[model samples]
Target: MDYIKLLFALLLFLVGCAGISPKPLSIDQRLAAIPRKDAPLEHKLIIRWNEQAVPYLEAGSDADLAFGLGLVHAHLRGGQLALLKRISQGRISEMAGPFTTKVDHALRILDLGRAAPQIEAALPDETRRWLERFVEGMNYYQANTPNTPPEFSLLGISFEPWTVRDVITLSRLVGADVTWFAYFSLLSERRKGQTDEASWRRLIATTQAGAPNFRAAENDSQLLHDLLRASGRSGSNSLALAPGRSQSGGALLANDPHLGVQLPNFWILAGVKSPSYHAVGMMIPGVPIFGIGRNPGVSWGGTNMRAAASDIINISDLDPAGFSKRSELIRRRLWPDAKREVRFSSWGPIISDAELLRGGDGETLALRWEGHDPSDEISAFLGAARAKNASEFIAAFKSYAVSSQNILFADSSGVIGQIMAARVPLRSTSGRASFIRTLDEAKQDWSTHLATPQLPMQLNPQKGFLASANNRPAQTNLFPSSLFSDDERVKRLEELVLSRPLWRVEDLVQIQTDVVSRKAPALRDDLLSFMPDEATKRHPTFVTQLKSWDGSYAASSRGALLFELLLSEVAHKVYADKKGRVSNAASQWSYLTAYLKTDLSALEPHLCKEILQDALDKAAKRADRFKNWGEMHRLPTQHLLARLPILGGRFTLADHPASGSRETVMKTYHGLERGLHQTSYGSQARHLSDLSDPDLNYFTLFGGQDGYLGSQNFADQVPLWENQQYVRLPLREDVVKAEFKRVLVLPN
Candidate 1:
């Protein structure tokens, strides 16, 4: 009776625990609790995951094991997403790939025409096992690996299962691979005829949509069908699928992404601990574990870089009058495909196919990413996540994967570093920075370029710091289409780093969080001009706040908010037209003023208006607009996941979320909220990083550690991150251990 009274009192103290409190449970024990093969999707998912993944998570790092719970939740929720990813064989065979297409064609036959006969007729005698493996692995892992059980915790930091629906919230985060518009060709192309004045806005209202099962075979099949549209006379391309790394530090990354976001955005957290090492980070469901994390001696993080483009060629349509000049038809392969059928649940052949690009061989190629080959990005990251030095980390680099990212490393040995890690295609110049792009293998070896380790750098610079704002590499001057903005940001970083020595992590954090006017120093003249001493009476109070504050743009600061508002108005009018007014990168805006000084007379009327309209508007309504940045730069998850036909033919789209706050991996806004544009959504995943590293971390869609809705973490870290503030990445505490409430031991 006395003990019961004490226990009851303690419950209130620990009231924040939303789910079942974890008790002591071993890997084998957790596996034993789930039923084996033939179990329902939910149960089969449980058994497969607890059987395989739990062993890795439990055996790996502690925080890793905790984060693994997100994988676990994904698996548990896999029934819907997985079932959705599965598609009809008819949809794929029409796709025109032999090995995969034939197998899928047979798979549909087996289902509709009956299994034994279909297999006998369609697949070779030896490959049935491969098909089985694919089916089983896809279903089980999708539903079970990222499982978040129906439990919760009060202390927001730990790993816990997600509710069935929370797993659905993972979509916005999965689409992070959109590369930067690197070169002036691409940038100017996107920037061409672009309005001088723009606002960030979205046509679709996405605040309440559900999730999609994109990785499922059905989804992949549908994706292939969609790719078939441009398949005519196109060549097929495939990657070697091997992973590589920098020659420094030990780091492993499990860079799984959480694609769409609403109230809460999430990923699994797992912890692996041993005296020699401990690592924690995220993992993806329906796939092997990890893309980024930390090991004992090394800590690392990464961002995306698209490094594929052709060699150099300066070809001109010369001598058009004569047929004697052969139209330089370089011999090569081109991938092409025939028209295909797509099975729509309600409408047959929902999406028609067209050949997109043909290879030199006139063969059609699949729409696969360069790094998506069965590579070891996970293993490479695992190796680097715990690396102790440059030498050891380079070894880990051998297995790195996914879209390219600029990795930054910091070790316990008082070393700080950065590496633009990716297989950037090779380049050649006609003795100048600007040159034509070519695909001639004889002259340029784009496929065999050196690793990211060989790129430019300030290795252990005199100043104890290194930074990257997705800028161009240090060794080059031209902003190649293969990469972007590296030199500008890199130069700026070098200036700041070399400016000071012995930077405290706090100082680095300040640098990482710096969001003041990248254009402010130049704007001083423009601002001062408006600072009529007598007219100062009409000056908004926030202007005074901005003038008094340091240049840092912390999210919650009044000055940061004011600047964001000013920019939002500008950005909305400049690009994507999501926000609809003004919101260019502060740094770019700074440069524009200089350009304006020299080119104002040559500027288009629209461009002229862009420069003056924003300051004019803010100056006129500084008090209202400058109240706070959040007013213009909101932390809203704009798109919702809804139904789309194909695969399970059931899923939602997270609509156009563009140009948001800086903390957001990619900024997003739709003209105030459903601004001008088409109604459909856009799914683009640009940045991928888990907060395992301090300097260059990608916080949550909502920012930081946990993203359980209704919990403090749901929106708790938004402002901290929006303002570029940060929460601590907790190292293991002595008391924190995996303690399951009930132990169920299983056979090894």
Candidate 2:
């Protein structure tokens, strides 16, 4: 289907006109429930008067939903968009309106650049101007949303250049399993710079116009709106905008957005009012809605699940005159911009040279790829914030403009939504577009994309239960997981949680917090493949320790001593080429086979000498010199606390921070030492967000409260986040009432 068409369908899912009911906790109660008590209210500060009163956020008897909603509403109106939403709702929160029809226009064609402007130019000038406003709305948020830090860094290790945008974009490029934004950027800076940052930035800007591009939202399911408007006669179902009550008779909505860890882990909260709606969220400074907020009965969040390539470019030593002329032929065909210009700093190919080719000279060649993905990476949240049910919730998904995410929803209607919504490209095994997994680059080709209709979903299952441990889908009917099978995190989540029944949100949270390492069992199984009989029995103590102890890498365990020995043995054999430097890009099996020789050596000084004898025999078949894996593949971690040459240099690669223990998270940031790894840390920051809903319903980041560490609410949360943990945020009015901290009124 056309990418635009899918977007049109998504756009048509926006909420329809429905009257919302009013529900609010007392003014005292709200104050007690504030997520950060130290941060003073904007209204309370004499120098900066709040435009509105905070008490009216949920003001029931006095609420006039329409009285406040307007096209232009923000701090000027006193409350932020999230606060406005707290008081506003229609009889129902439906997703349907003329605005969606315009969305369908872009969805009708795959290339928004080609379709939107051409179609709009043919329209009356006034009509075109009206349409541009909404586009401006999106850009406004993108440009103005404060760049905040993630709630915290893990292990005292913080990423320096890992932008919130990089988190969302990389998630789209790499599968959610990888977290190497800063790593990739640091290592690939030379090549990415060779590719040209200005041109790349411009290319990204074009996709932001809400146009339907293959890269914009992968396929159409990620589009926020569909280009095809559902005519009145079309009779398609609309998202249920009416407030829904769950079995407990409580209004519900679930949102799990994917974002990064930054100084500020979330958007700033602002209240918005319009004749059409009242909502509150981090209004993002200039944006009209609270991207992550709730109107009494509705609220939302996101979790990253973007899918893309995770490989790096490799350099070669072959002279231009040597071997295959096909390299020359391919370069000629691939790069037509022989005279393309390169700005001072760049990566890969020049923008003017759309045709990327291998540049010769002893210098080396450049390549491009999707980097690793992270967990936090969502660009937008407001549309879903207003959704009332699964269908409408999906409509909000139409804007799938942000990064990849698996959105979970629950509403007062007892309806629930669990959708894997993202901009995942269909790649072949060789790392290019294709329907089949073929490593042959010559055979790969882009396939037609899916539309909003193609969304991967499991709504209101008969089991009345759903969970996401940031894993691939359990519903076998869906396409291949954006991730691979070897991912330990996903594997564990599936084994422990999906194997059982999950009914409540707590069940899901339990699975998420599961830090138990089943790695010992997996390693044991790998070891079982070999018997002790294979040992030479020369080192009685070595054999005794291996056989008697369980395979555990606990910090204090001697097992780590053994494991480190194995690593050293294996690394020494695989990384040492003829020059004694590192270079083992050959077959992984060769490295593994050579490393096994070390284990044999460890067993007996000479009893197992045959393993090395056999490895030497195998090397005769290859042209390259020998090397060890450890010499070439040192664990490269983005640790901020380290001060080694490889660890402290703006971008280091020699020594790794600390990893490889099954319990410790580890990922490969592939690239050679040639300008590889510029940013030592990484591009992602993570934080689990939840509003003051008492249920851990909100998350945020950045230098909130003007960078104040002592007085700002944002400051206190930083420490908890630095530890990769969370604190409570109860949204109950009663809780707020009892511990009432402070209150201010937002004026309309």
Candidate 3:
């Protein structure tokens, strides 16, 4: 009887541990559980949605088109837009909880919100009115739409009226990401203790291109770390062909802005038309104009012009009178009584000691970011959207003040041009210095900027082709403080362009997705020469694979995978600096390729053969795990909700097998900090514009436009984008109206 009682007690404990089961619903009940909404169109404006739900807005005026853009943007990406505004305002913790408190703190220090009102007040009346109309449209969408994205309901947050300041804030956020202030900070710290000044200068000259700068070291706190990680590491490709070089007797332009891959892509496809003009391209959600696209006969696209627009100042004994003190109450949903005070000097916001080190003489450090200063980039893009020809487009480039970009222009008149548009700081006479270590030294910095004429620009170059892959604009006259990308991409681009005589738009697209690596063949030759008889006998399969490789990182090529692994291992063995906490040599292809081709005496002592043999054995093992390269080289499209176990799988775009290594023109690059072959960064958007037929302009995004889960358009582009397919971005209004499935009219 006692044994029976014990068994019964054990069963009860088991049942209790199991917990109550969640209630299950039948199919009928599940069908009925869907959320209902009543969203009707207003009468003032007309919106036509394509089969993919991309909106085409036709308004009586430009302001109305702005209103329509805001309305559609709010409906499709309300959650993302709201979150961006919240983050920029340093109010993310109010909705996202404690995890984002650090992000909030960093944003508060950056203080784009404080600078927004002043920026808005000083804007031209035309730009200001357009922004106002955009705000009204967003507000109207919020009032009329009965339902919001599931994320809002899950977080228990509601959308608020977006102000024009929010638009300015978005631009500031973009500027912070693309700016290189934190890059110089890390480079400065890394270059410390180098006694040989000449060697240091030479090292700067050699390694400045492709710094391989990551977000931050693992030990870093969230503030400086976030700043380092803001822009993340990215590269781009852009080119234009003159009429003489084109197969169709018209110019062609191509661009693919490489950015951190994400779902609900950083851009949205939109077509806006008013009586004044027509524009179409990938529009950042909050901004009114298409950042890279065409209007009528003119088409334009850009790459981040890696300009030196930010600086870190070491303040030795700052005067309190020259600054303002404020306390930012970091509101938290989870943590209570969390408040902190921070100070800002005349230079900029002071970096906290916890985030970065203070000077030795009881000094603080401040960051003077050019983005905080008021400038008008929005007006420039708006003007560009209305530009009809090459000269008009070049005129629009003159007013750009904040962000730097390499603009490529092609028009109906057979003209091709390039503009290095940026608010380039007129550095002091000694501005060639990479580090400005004293606050007094940087006090009068950026006092003057390069005038529009001073900016490097060319129209119809005699070469018949112009290209920029974030490379040095000119061999001699580069921007004084520019940190250009590695020259390999540009060199390879020139080879491909020069090799071809008569180019077509299709040929340009082929170049955009080209996977041939210039360094691979030479490296393969070196490995063959280094292989000993013993290695050749033991690793015959590896030797055979290496010999058979054509150097293209095609998905089926196992040799490409093996070579990438071998290269990474060799880099680790060769450039592992004991003093520098991080080694960036592995990701710097130009440096590594150059080093490998040099004499054996140049290599680390006793490492050349030893490292090669070890890498071969490891590669053999790694090779066995995968049937081919496609199985190993995967592109992981991480989503914000991917952190959640249940929702993660649902939100993430399908992990597709990606081709191309860091050295390829297809150019999917990953950091050495992460595991090799992990596709973290690559081209997020690709465009091929044909001047022969403007309506035939084709482009693709890594993902689709919609951010909402229920929307079919969400993640719709992934399959085609992965397959290197592009959809038409029709320029004609009649075609757009015919392709659309739904029409929405807004009340004026």
Candidate of highest lDDT: 3
Alpha-carbon error at 708 in model 1, in Å? 8.3
Model 1, 190-264: lDDT tens per residue? Answer: 223332221111100111001111111233333432222111001100000001121122121212122334322
> 692-720, model 3: which lDDT tens digit per residue?
87676777877777766555566677777
**How good is model 2 by TM-score?**
0.46
TM-score attained by model 3 = 0.86
Considering lDDT, where higher is better, how would the candidates rank from best to worst? 3, 1, 2
Q: Against the true structure, candidate 1 has what lDDT?
A: 0.32
TM-score for each of the candidates: 0.51, 0.46, 0.86
Q: Model 3 off-target regions past 4 Å? A: 1-44, 177-203, 211-213, 219-234, 352-363, 428-436, 439-445, 476-478, 524-533, 577-582, 585-587, 596-600, 603-607, 644-647, 673-677
Candidate 2 per-residue lDDT, tens place, 1-748, comes to 2464345333322221011111233323322322222321222211111111122233221122211211122222212222111111100011222222222222211111112233333534432332234333222322332321111111111112212132122223222123122112222223333223332233222211101101111122222111111000000000111122122234233332222212222234333333223344443322223444554445444344423322222333324333221110111111121221221111121111111221223333322222121121121244455554446667755434223445555554455556655544354432222111222331232242332347567676654445443344444323333222123444454455445532233333333333334554444333323324434243444435534545433323433333334333333444444543332211122222323434444565453344333322232222122122233223332122122122223222135222123222221212222111221111122222222233433332222311111123423433432333332233454543333344433231
Better of 1 and 3 by lDDT: 3
In model 3, the clashing pairs are 42-745, 42-746, 42-747, 43-746, 43-747, 44-746, 44-747, 44-748, 45-746
Return the lDDT, model 3, position 96: 45
lDDT of 3: 0.66
